[model samples]
Target: MSEKFEIRREVVVPGTPEQIWAAISAETAGWMFPSPLEIPADGSRPDSPIIADWEPPRELAIHMQGPDGWFNNLEYVVEARDESTAVVRYVHAGVFAEDWDNQYDGASKHTDFYLHSLGQYVQYFAGRPVTYVSAEGPEASSAPEAMGALRGALGIASGATAGDTVTVDVPGIGTVEAIIDYIDDWFVGLRTENALLRFYGRNAFGGNVDAAHHLFAADADGDAATAAWQAWLSGVFA
Candidate 1:
């Protein structure tokens, strides 16, 4: 139980550090976590990762030992890279105390997917980004299978490449306009006129697929958009 490993990921998005900072406030927590995680009260770390260091327009680092009880400290670091991009690094350093194989593998894929989603979402924040809306579907499939369900539902070919302007007929949302911004076996990202969306194909506890939705929106369109998208996702993954 002494073996250790690290899962590192980084990305560059289109914006200055200052801009990226704004996009990642409490509002965008949904884009990362499965739910909106309220920022812990100042100087308090109760099971949740404490905001160890935050130098806005530059770096934000939080220190926490989670997936808790796993005996590991995870640090999520963000570094601004000028006005057109930024980098995020997720460091998971700890002993392979238990379930190392599964935990490490999932962490590797998920960290990559989340970083990409966050970067894309931040690219079009519009200065008025609203709270993120999130939802999850079933726990009965693999990540690839979960992603396959979404692609099949949207009539998107696995061959679809980024930068393609495609329109998908969402089950309950009518026609939705989107530009494919990122695609991989484990995740797919889309840019809509009013928001950024993601199909996260991650494995959950029960060998089920963690089908998730993350969106960046405005106060006026938040509820409606969340309803429409969550409805469509339910239909697709249900």
Candidate 2:
């Protein structure tokens, strides 16, 4: 008989089933881990003798080769009871062997990291509140100058003409439009409502702008906005 191990975890997220799926199914492997699996240099899913079985919002199964010529079976199942909670289970099976212990340890570590990271990612992408601060107060005499500095820090060109909107891209997330709403002496507030609106369109209008808004809010800080923008672009283009 094959040795079996199962790990189950429940994560409460402020997102829907669709949102969870999007994160897991993202093209970038690192979304689930700090270091992604190395595949072909051409970026193709390896032609390993692995098979996948997927049933959306429910289950996914894979049978693949393990280290030392071992064969392993892995299954991931999602059970959603409501809009805010889900139980995910990961199960592994393989034949027992002298090297089985090592394989199991490595697999367990990687899978655990993947699951934990995924949960955190889902929660984060599901909208989190963020705050912005300016060096000068709204009524300060140098507010406009401070706003210019803020915009420049965010990589918005100092000479960028008015009415120009820049696409802020994020990976595993999508692109958001950052309209230079207004640059005053006190602060610069980039309007991303349109970007949020556009995201809704691609996500089948999942009716979760609250989550998207949270994502933008968390990212709409100082130079961080530029990094967030680039991440969104990579996710979209990837």
Candidate 3:
């Protein structure tokens, strides 16, 4: 049997409604994943989807259904606070095939991180192109000390919190002075001069550790970044 889940989060950021809409729509790669948010040009359902709502600079919603009554939906309602700020109300609803509790917990927490990243992108790096590099650590990453080792490698102390400044020696990438943008037991976010670095302690959720880099430099090289990070992760978990 499948289980249903819905995650809602609201964020107030320094951007107009139009800007927020663009960030979530056309410029999603700046903060979220690399896939484009495609809306069908014909106004018809394709891939079992319906564009339930489409009001530019205000609201957008999409719903998709699977053959076995499984459905996933995304909705964003942007409200302008003034000329320079807006509030984004987002909802992510879906069904999971199994492991209902664990799935819901991970998905809900992931929403928080993604929304925080969205605010960061809108505030600082809005509309910039990004080269996203993701790497999975070795099997030993599931060990409890895996994330701690990576943090120690970056010179972050055990009790570090957001907003602390530190210089990071990024392996094969170069050294950078960064701010701890976000941190929790299962995640770490670093904001450098030109990139957002994210570390996922997925062992807390039954997976290996993962690292993702969102490089916003004009000359970013995704291939080299991925290769370097993968090697670093392998060494860390080995």
TM-score of each: 0.74, 0.39, 0.91
- The runs of at least 3 residues in candidate 3 whose Cα sits more than 4 Å from the true structure, single-residue gaps closed, are 36-50
Model 2 lDDT-worst window of ten: 202-211
Candidate 2, 125-162: lDDT as tens digits: 33333332211112222222433433443456766753
Candidate achieving higher lDDT, 1 or 2 = 1
For model 3, state the Cα shift of residue 222 in Å. 0.9
lDDT of 2 at 120: 49
Each model's lDDT comes to 0.61, 0.44, 0.83
Q: Could you tell me the lDDT of residue 89 within candidate 3? A: 93
Please provide, for model 1 over 9-96, each residue's C-alpha lDDT reduced to its tens digit, 9 standing for 90 to 100: 6677676666666555444554565323454545232244456555664555554455634545455456766656767655766666
lDDT at 178, model 2: 73
Off by over 4 Å in 1: 1-5, 24-27, 34-49, 65-83, 87-90, 94-97, 139-144, 203-207, 216-231
In candidate 3 the C-alpha lDDT for residue 217 amounts to: 97
Q: How many steric overlaps are in each model, in order?
A: 5, 12, 0
Relative to the unseen true structure, what is the C-alpha lDDT of residue 198 in candidate 1, on a scale of 0 to 100? 72
Per-residue lDDT tens digits for candidate 3, residues 1-238, read 8988899988887888877877776666777677444635542332423677778878888888888889999999999988888988999999999989988888888789888888888888887878888999899999988888888877789789999987866588878789999888788889987988888888878898898888999999999999988988898777
Candidate 1 vs 2: which has more TM-score: 1
